[model samples]
Target: MTPAVAGASVQPDGALHAYARARLADGDGALGLAVASYRAALVQDPARVEIARRSYVQGLESGDRALALQSAALLDQVGMLPRDGTLLMIGEALTRKDWAGAETLVGRMVEEGNFAFIAPIVRSWIAIGEGRYAPPVIDSKDRFASLGLRYADEHIAFQALARRDLAAATPAIRRALAVRSSDGAALRLAFAGQLAAQGAKAEALMLLPVGSAGFASARVAIGKGKGLKAAGAAVTPAQGYARLLSRLAVDVGSDKAGGTLALRLARMATFADPAGAEPHILAARLLTLQGYAPGAITEAGKVPARSWYAPIAQAELIDALAAAGDEPAALMLARAQAAELGAEPERQVRLGRLLAEAKDFAGAAAAFRAAQAAYAPDQLPWTLLLFEGSALEQAKQWDEARAVLQRAAAMAPNEPLILNYLGYAQIERRENVEAALELLKKASALKPQDASITDSLGWAQFVTGNVEAAVPVLERAAAGAPTDITINEHLGDALWTAGRRYEARYAWAAASIYAEGDVAARLAAKSKEGLKPEYAAP
Candidate 1:
């Protein structure tokens, strides 16, 4: 493809050179350098709309607030500023406590009708900052009506707390929490911090859930009478509004509607409140999902180590580094985090999951074992045992894997997954065929809709010399999960055993579609030669 800036051949200038450099850096994934070059280009040719637009987006992606604001100003001057750009302008006014300027921008937002839902909220904050205590009125018909109302009330609560009006703040916070869908833990923690800061330590302590590792630092601080020093507490209208924007970002992200708008809101939130951790974490997650791993790492690395979200940010950073093709750095960071938070089983499990994703099965098994050791032998959870057994199995430690799986099965007798795993492993190892068949039968019964479990039961039937029954069961399994290579292969074996030679070849052909390596070779052989003599007659 020809470069858009290939116009460097036509009356070249410094701006053209810088624009070409920026485009190259952008294609090379050096987003920070791209933003810098774009900024330089814009500085050289302030009238270049193309340069301004490119710099505006790259600035947001690279977390360059100055560049974003500079480009945003140029765009606004030409009446080409996007809604989010206008938002950035409003946020800047709010940050500097320029109430009149913010009100003017809010008027612009209202006239544009692009961000109408949030315009009222921003205007309410501007009013509050200007000493007007009018309540926020949300239109019940707005698309984000619930969220708008919830966040407005939350801001009011924060504003009340700042005024030491606990009588009003408490109920507003309670109303916000009631409307919140996903546990509202962050709100509880932040509100608790504000309460502690207001000398209501007992009330603050009551807001936190007992025995949560993330709240340990906050709890200790409040206990020591030092007040909660966390960064997320909203002590002012602007910070409260930032928190609300961060929540809206998460809402948009959850819809899987693409990350561009979510990242915009997240970047705006981070700019509006530099000390807040949630916005940084949200921005990092969105960037990572969009395959901008370097940008993700930068966002995650912004969270202060003393904040409540530091551990979450560390995990995000490790994952981002791994995604960026720096596995060694990811491993080093994961190992350091696991060691530091070794007492927390959750962190160890996260490390184990990361190792598993990296295909370091033995390391994953070892991490899972560390997680197991965190619990008493008698108190071990079946889920942990299952994870350890699966990792060990993948690591080729079959003997230990079987033992751990057996323990898991005994602990969770009704769990279809545990039953299916143990039964399937026993069948593969050709040990205790009768017991394996019974286990598979129960698993198939427990989860009739599960194609894999049904496939295991049918395979067990074929191994037990029930060819007639196996053929139909395997057919059902194959029909349920038509794309499943293993199920189709198992169906082929059953059909071949039952003398349906032509249909068996068709089944093998279906299984061969996505097969790879040895499986592909074996499927090709099966389609041509049927089964081996001993297996041909079941």
Candidate 2:
């Protein structure tokens, strides 16, 4: 499979061989190799739109900026530039100070009508670059009219503040923040940072609401009489363009199907303004969603410690580390975050969940208890009680677990999850069998389609010597959740009680497929020896 194409002397089949290699690498999740192979294929046959498109996407995913830009240029040459390509080309035009060229690209984007609401904002920036800045006309008839108006007011305020026109900036920024559809936290941080950058620290402090976690870094800086420098202010045309694209990346990412497109836009925004935090955050989230853990961590880590979104980025970075199979690092980071943000109950809860996932049940319970202590008495969350109780139970603290579970059950009396859990735990311990059966029945009624709750009810019946009743319910549970280990094992026990030895063995075999440790040994023993003779069926 050596190249045979003209000027491509490395492969026999040239582009075809390279394309096949790229697809194979991509299918194996080797994005770096995929991007390189795709680039080599495109080099052999520059007109291959499919190869160019794949190279462009993989380049962005793999954090290969050069390959992304090269493919974007190729897409533009073929007049088939995607949204991200159009944005990159406009950024290039802006860098070259080609206002007319940027506006021409905006015109093409408007004609396409996919995300045309942003065209006016892009044009406004281009005009500002051309020394002809003006307030954008809000089209009430536009599809994204509300969004357009919010950004329009935001830009007006930004320009006013840049010129030190306090009167105009005051009302414009207020109006923009009043809409609440756009990211108010980001807007506040940006506007406040702009004010600080302009030496109006007092005014910036006034704009940032008190006790806003997102503004923690900014508040500290402004309190120190230090001016906070933001990456984007809509003062420069390129910065304005990057700001809008980053916001667009966030907006587009709300749609589950638009992740890849959102990542492309986020990467393009980063390319335009490397220091902007929002685009990096958006890219991190998109990368996490796409299962690119290392890329997610890198993007999240890019947020400077002094950035307004630093806390959020730090949290996301910890999560990315856990997703990347570095739970020890994740736990270390989570513990540090909890210690630093002692008043934030959510951080403690996050730490608790991570500890539980790592099988440190006692540590998890302690973290959950800490979260509970951090919360005000009136604001105590029942969910935290549930988590703490579950952890304590796993740690073999039966009395404390029961007490905490009862408190959770009292707080959320009708919650099916709480009911199911409490019922299942009681049934397992052979405590208050009749009451546990009632709870399981209520939970089953609340969530009719829940196989787990149904399995609990069936198991309760079996342990109570209602073997005839248990057999049918366990069969139904097994059918509902065919591969669930617990459900299948319970079905085996119920079938064995009903004198169905062959069917019991079959059920045990199914459960054994995914069982491990002590459960695996127990299932294997049961499959060979059948039901114990401790008092068969009464």
Candidate 3:
């Protein structure tokens, strides 16, 4: 027995136990480490098919393609490969231009009843590559047909583009656009590029919807006679692979899976095109959304400095730093970006937001002022004015705050939040009582369920000698916002004025639980001595 210990004996039981423990301990946030630990465990017992399956998925999610491939090979040898593993293997074959191998894998996946909707697109692409035109047939009766139609049309257009058949591509693009009103951003961008390449510059520009700066920039590039050949085309194997990955990333990123799959796919895209900033930008955004700030920062840093996406990546990096509680670093980066951008109102607004978050109200106000100076008279966002007013209020510049808030209220007359804020500020200042009441009434009407607005309305009534009317409104506000200290405090004052001393004491006790600083002290005194006659309603 001792002599028979040839090489290293695989302890399947021990390895399986370790893998189970690691799986249990590895939470979603530490997925990268979990995948590595899984790989190490698998190495100890290579014949463990179940462990191999899990390792393959974890590797894909963590962007460890080699590990995924290795696990896939192991799973295939044991007849335990899942549909996803088969797809990955097929993708790898396609990447290497091994069309025969991809076809074989695709056949196996189809036989297993997996990804029935997607399998045909792979076949269609393969057929187009072989100089045969075989368009995918999507049955509308199929359960997945609605979801698959847009992807099918888009892929058909790509195949057409690969074959340099603009006539064929145009109709497919139109079919895709017809499937969903708001479904296409990347698709439209690619189609616009094709239009521009055909010398239809106005048509291309018209295709680009408003609010997409990326598409706008591409329109500018096309206008300069840069020709949309490169932008519109994905004929190369690498480009097709990257485009597929980006589409999958978008689909998966919208779910509760929290961007892990999206980030991995984007990472693969970067390997396909190192100079392309889109993949890196997508990865950075995914990481940020998943609360992996450090990872986001690293991905954002990978974008080329001269790339069109660099500024956007930099802004995301700054936001990531701020979200990660590195506010000082965020502020420093924002300031640098603002200086570099030079009178860009967007950057100025970003600087103001960062400063406001850091409690540097004066600095925030200054940044907002700079933004206001840069904007044309008619172009200022009401949000900009609101932020400026709030910052000035925080900085104790009351007159400036009032003036800014008034202008904001004028511009956004129907905005409930603006109305509520200005009205509450006026009430606190003990000036413009009638105007404040009117504003609060409008806000309450606009947002009937809003507890804060109701509280403000109730408090206004109390301050204006309508004690009985205040009591019911304050009661409703307190019911809606059971834990809001201000609402409870106002309810307590109203109850006291309505001659319900015991109920008032109970309300003050509730308010005390959430009170802090000066409010807490005031509540404590009120609870001890009840309200003084001076504080009671007339």
Write down the TM-score of every candidate.
0.74, 0.81, 0.68
Predict model 1's lDDT versus the native: 0.82
- For candidate 2, the 10 contiguous residues with the lowest summed lDDT are 1-10
Residue 332 Cα positional deviation in candidate 3, in Å, after optimal superposition: 2.3
Task: Give candidate 3's TM-score.
Answer: 0.68
Lowest lDDT sum, 10 consecutive residues, model 3, at 1-10
Give me the displacement of residue 150 in model 1, in angstroms. 4.0
Model 3, span 1-538: residue lDDT tens:
1222234354555665556654764565566677777888778777877678778877765567777888889988978776556666766777777878878877987788746667667777667656688877877898878655657777777777766677887788788777534435545666677667776677677777543443556666777967466665555444555666666677778886737667666766665555556667777777778776776777788876644355677777887888778998989988987776333666788899999988899999989988787668788888889989999999999999999999999999999889998998888787898899899999999998999999999998888778988899999999999999888888998898789999998999998897898888888888888897544321
**Which structure among the candidates has the greatest lDDT?**
1
Q: On residues 1-538, what C-alpha lDDT tens digit does candidate 2 reach at each position?
A: 3233335344566886898789899888777688888878878887878778778887777767778888888888888777667777787688678998998888877777776887778877777787876767778987789778756777778778767787889889888788644456666777888887777778888877665454666788877755455422446777677777776777678898888788887887777777777678777877878777888999999998866778778878888898889999999989988887433677788899999999899999999999898668678888999999999999999899989999998988888888888888988898998999998899989997888988999999998889899888888989999998999899998898789999999998999999998788788888888877531221
lDDT of 2: 0.80
Clashing residue pairs for model 3: none
Candidate 1, after superposition: displacement of residue 408 in Å? 8.1
**C-alpha lDDT of residue 416 in model 1:** 93
Put down candidate 1 lDDT per residue, 239-288, tens digits, no spaces.
76687777777777777774778888888888998877777888888888
Predicted structure 3: lDDT: 0.75
In candidate 3 the C-alpha lDDT for residue 277 amounts to 60
